[model samples]
Target chain A: MMVSLRTKSSFLKIYSWLPILALYISVLNEFDLNYLNLEYFSFNFPFILIFFFTLKDFKHFDYFLVFIAGLFNDTVVGLPLGISSLSYLLICIAAAYIRNITIRPNPVKDWFYFLFIISLINSLNYTVLTLFFSFDLILMSYLVNVFFTFTFYIIFVSIFKYYMRGLND
Target chain B: MASSRDDFIIAIRSAFLKKSTKQKFSLLTLLSISIFVIVLSSLDLKVIKYLKVGINEIVYRSSFIVSIPENLIKNAFIQTTEYTTFFNRYKRNIIELENLKSNYVSNEIIQFENKELKELINNYALSSDKILAKIIVDHDSPFLKSIIINKGSKDKIKIGTNIYDQSYLVGRVIEVNYKTSRVLLLSDLNSNVPVTIAPQNIQAIVTGSGSDYGQIKYIQSGLSDALVDDSIVYTSGTGAIFKSGVPIGKLQSFIGGSINEYKVEFYSDFTQLKYVFAEVITKTEIIKPEEKVAENNDETNNPLNVKLKILEDELKIIEETNRKFQEENEILKNEINDLNFKVSNLNNQISSQKKTINQFDIDNQELDFLKLNLKHGHKCRRTFLNTDGFIVGTLEYKSCVLSKGANDG
Candidate 1:
């Protein structure tokens, strides 16, 4: 009985680290389903995952790990080494600021805050990639990405809440 | 108001500098490091380049391994769709194969002739061997159309080396690591290919439309009117960036009010690419016999002798061209002689035909006279019963036979 309990706790510990694992997997796999043939159909899954976990102040979500994931994303997507890192770090900062300011956390408020943060971050990404790095990026693609990321945030947040509930149990 | 402002400042500072127990670095430090890295990357430092190559080599391999499940799913989806349209696609492919088979010989001949011409103009021949490469990462990013391949500088892949899907131009290598490279696809907004629109032969530049298609730019103002839909668009080899005559796409014209737009429908689908060929080119310089002799005599270092050798090569080329022209002239002269002989044979046939027609006419006249004699000859007969009849075998008798016995009068 004691061994089974220990195994159960071990499984819970692993389960608690699911968000970071998902971030790494998303970056490596480039979770965009391009086979759908939808034009401008990409969403920043890592951004949503990072924002939600950072806002919740999840214990296992390490800042250094997130930064490394950003670098991996840049390598995979052929972007400059630090471009994604900058964007991801900015997202974490925004989520942290929001978490610090809120006295009572509300899901609706958080959802709207995610929209504003993603829009600003995506705009900054576009500006940096275009003006600083001289990368030719379509403004429409960035806008579409922002839209999809914002829309999918609530859905992923609910699923994450379930995971958190299971971890609490 | 002062308390609220203080609270705002405290919250901001905490977000920037505060680190929780699980977090090692403050968000502000990471932010600063990120910005610094971005600046360094943009500066193109050599150390950063090697560091990036090391990071790319590791990350690309890991990404490829991690991507296996997703790639399998993608392949399954594609295979499902392919199977659904299997029969129709097979039918279409069969017809296309036959048409391509008919054109293959002519295309080879043209390719050989073009190679010879290019070698003649430039003193070196470019021999290219295409090495097949597997795509390691194909994320199909919304903002950037690029892919990572498994072949890189280790395989002699240089930046700007042309990548192809079969004979169709796909993209070019933009970044090369030790064993991996990134290809900036032609669908990227930054990619520009110098192309010739065929049938009209208008030269233009094709820039990516940030979509699957490309937009035609830098063309003459009124030449757009001459561009027909489905006209071939191929690289023109201008600026020596790409080899000439590599097929890119076909022209698609769209018309709006007071506007004409032309797009290129790429021959190879960038999304469907699984493996690509990277062309590794080697150039070999052509030396003339005179230049070889000069080299053997150890006078190759003399500039005057080099110039004379070049002039001699030019003279040899001119003489060769003249010889070809003379040979063509001789062939044309033989063709003209053959045509003249045929004309003489036809004239002889015509004269013999005319003689036969004259004989036929004479026979017809005699037959007519015999028929007339059967009916009206009794009145003009030169028998003893008639007083003014001529002798039977005389010229007058022959005249009488011809003129219906008018001489009997």
Candidate 2:
């Protein structure tokens, strides 16, 4: 059965705000499965979620709520308070720019654009953390994170496309 | 070219200034806020610090609650892995337990002695009480290794408080709230511990590698050759941050190109942490006996004064021992005097008994002589029939009577 909000139940109401709710939970919980013993394995779920939903211009995905989620992410991850907020808002701005520039939405173009944006953002994150905060971060870890998040973007985007199709129905 | 530039400008302006009906804050406004928050957070203002703590308190508790399902899954995965190696782990644990048991008694003694020695070296002695804190959130993030514990200022958990997983150094509390705190695990890139490499006696800084282990950094030049594989690493208490002699990890040397690189495999596993002990230390100043005199010399921070104070302490101990020995000598002297008096009294009693026995022997001899005289009196009496008779009162008469009695018999 196709899932739509026309049924007008509490579950449907929650379904409408699922993307924002997911951003909150992801920031709060950091659903990364580190216990899988994958030493070099991590992906930024919020980055993917924020990029896709903002690029699509989903009505329930509020920018303020995204900012709040960024604050929560900073608190949970023990980064200097606003570093994650900055990184997250930067992601939003990048997605918004891409969304405005594109008339014909092509997955291939968006995918390449995402790679560039994330690279810039990750590099910015590294420089800010190291130079300003004096954080001793491994450059290689950042590189690996960028690689994994970039690779997993395609997979999550497909799933998100299905979700969007269901919600639109 | 002009049309393309205009289109680019329009897109950029739309992205920055445009807001949808559902969005409250424009992208530019939020970006500005993000930068503002970053700058404010970097400042050490009291308002920001408290604000950060408040945010941390709420966020940590929320994260803990939100993490329950994921934690359950994680625990299940861990338990599943544990079940796979149940017997092997059990066997290894048993062996480790046995080794630990044998070392435990000695370790306790050493710890007690260490407290005493520390007290001797410093005027204030630190007594630590380890409070158990449950780990509420441990995500093991790749970028930052940290955990949130369900203990904070309310539980006397302060910033810089050492966290331990069964006596092994796990981390230190970097942020403390009212009901929760954040511990920067030893595996975090930001963590730096001053450590002493044992058997080699080299001091080095062990910084987190953002991995499961630590990397040994800032060793004294030319001393890297002394470092061997499997050397014990422990906190040196330098800079007075971490408690001294706490076991941190073991050094593993990787030999490669021209210079050897070393890694520290921590004793406590950062991923497997569930509960940790937060050490709350209280320092009590030792009251010196000569403190009255030394009140004028209150420069306790000075090295020379400290040395002098240690010397005074040594002198006081020696003087106390001498006083004890003097008291014992006086008791012994009194005991000897009592023994000597008893010996003199016993000698007097022995002399009196000897005189009484001599008198009794004399009386018996006189009586025997009288009886012999009576018996022979008739034979020896100055009668004409006895030619050898003598006067009774004379000594010669007695002899003659005795001889006559013997002859008749």
**DockQ (Cα-based) per candidate?**
0.67, 0.58
lDDT of 2 by residue, B29-115 (tens): 988998999999999999999999899988998999999999999999999988999999899999999999968755655655566
**Candidate 2 docking quality: incorrect, acceptable, medium or high:** medium
Global CA lDDT computed for model 1:
0.88
What is the lDDT, from 0 to 100, of the residue A33 in candidate 2?
Answer: 89
Q: Which regions in candidate 1 have their CA more than 4 angstroms from the true location?
A: B293-409
Error (Å) of candidate 1 at residue B168 is: 0.4
Number of the top-ranking candidate, with DockQ as the measure: 1
Per-residue C-alpha lDDT of model 1 across residues B270-362, encoded as one tens digit per residue? 989999999999888887545577668875657787677667756765676666668768988999999999999999999999999999999
Instruction: Tell me what fraction of the real C-alpha contacts between chains A and B each candidate also makes.
Output: 0.85, 0.87
Q: lDDT, candidate 2, residue B93? A: 94
